[model samples]
Target: MNRPSIARPRRPRNHPDRFLECQRAVEDTVVSAIGEASAAGWQKDEIIAAMIAVADDMQLALNAKVLLSVETELGKLMKKYR
Candidate 1:
């Protein structure tokens, strides 16, 4: 049996509006994951630490400015959820 191929949406590299759309998609996914983790009894610190680890892994792909932004936002989120 052969599985059907899934078609992924192609995002335009230079489109300003597409960038916002992608950001919103990422935000939604992260929020959903956090909620699921919380429901699964993960502590707030654990969740935040997991996110930090993910960010650390992403360092190779992210610029310094973006990494700083992510860290700053994670700090804010950690405080908000505490």
Candidate 2:
């Protein structure tokens, strides 16, 4: 049975422009969060920790997206071969 396609924001594989846009969006979010945290009197260490946590979360999310894309392509190849 064919799996239903889920619509997602896909970055074109032929260009890095969308990838850069994603990075810029992440950076903007992190900066804004840090500013708010600082304004709330978060200490330097606390702010750095928050930044690191955000970065880690972003990396994990990116990795998961790449894995999902690879898995979908692999499934397509398998079906084509079968």
Cα-lDDT of candidate 1: 0.75
Each model's C-alpha lDDT? 0.75, 0.75
lDDT score, residue 33, model 1? 70
**Top candidate (TM-score):** 2
Give the TM-scores of the predictions, in the order they appear: 0.46, 0.56
User: How well does model 2 score by local distance difference test?
Assistant: 0.75
Clashes of each: 0, 0
User: How close is each model in CA RMSD to the real structure?
Assistant: 14.8, 10.9
Regions of candidate 2 where Cα sits further than 4 Å from its true position:
1-36
Kindly provide the TM-score of model 1 when superposed on the true structure, using C-alpha atoms: 0.46
Runs off by more than 4 Å, candidate 1: 1-11, 61-82
